[model samples]
Target: SIKEKPSSKAEKEDENPGTVRILLLGAAESGKTTLLSQIRMLYKQTFTESELIHRRAYVYNHIVSSMKAILAFASANDLQLSLDNQQRAKEILSIEECLGPFTQQEYDAIENLWKDPAVQEAYKKRGNFNLNDSAK
Candidate 1:
């Protein structure tokens, strides 16, 4: 085997920089878009800042933005549940899953569930999330 020596600043500069990739997923108006904006801005990256800010502003103006309070409540409850994990991110969620792709039964169940007093109470107490373990 050949020995390799560490490089100096000029040598390091000759090499290309590493790349990082992130993926965002959510419904329309979810903060996936907003978060991406904040990330690019906070990084002070060499990109089109005005365009990004304009798009983020448009999302806020025309779409539902992130909810701060209900999300905090849900995070607190989830923390209390002791789900400490590094493999996955800590999430503040919404119940878009409950609506699913919409079978007739799921659609009817959704309409009925929305009117449920208990469901409303749960939403207020915790963040909106589907409690049902199995979703089709």
Candidate 2:
């Protein structure tokens, strides 16, 4: 673990200061968040339950959004879903953004859609569109 150094005004006046600052820059899923989480752990900065809950909600929301994007791409590219999964895709797209965390049925629908060949094809070209890191 890296420890923070305590410095006085006199230290600030010194040729070399004790304080160090780091700047992180990256695109999505490029490990920026992972690095920050590791740094927070090293500094004993634990996330609360409420924060974890919010992260869970974020994951759920990401699933919904990713599915929607994949479905739209499939439609635009003439990728056809199976008869069963076509209905599932429609249900996924119809989901309201603020409907909250997914229910079991909704989760099942998402899982099934994810397994669809048409959705998988669109997912392969996910880089062409803007999707969440969690979507991967």
Every model's TM-score: 0.28, 0.69
Candidate 1 residue 128 C-alpha distance from true site, Å:
14
lDDT scores of the candidates, listed in order: 0.42, 0.80
Candidate 1 residues 1-136, lDDT tens each?
Answer: 9855647865555454664566798975466866886887798865577775665555332211122232344455653322221111122123232211434543454444434443344455542453321111
**RMSD of candidates 1 onward, in order:** 15.0, 7.2
**How far out, in Å, is residue 22 in model 1?**
1.2
Best by lDDT: 2
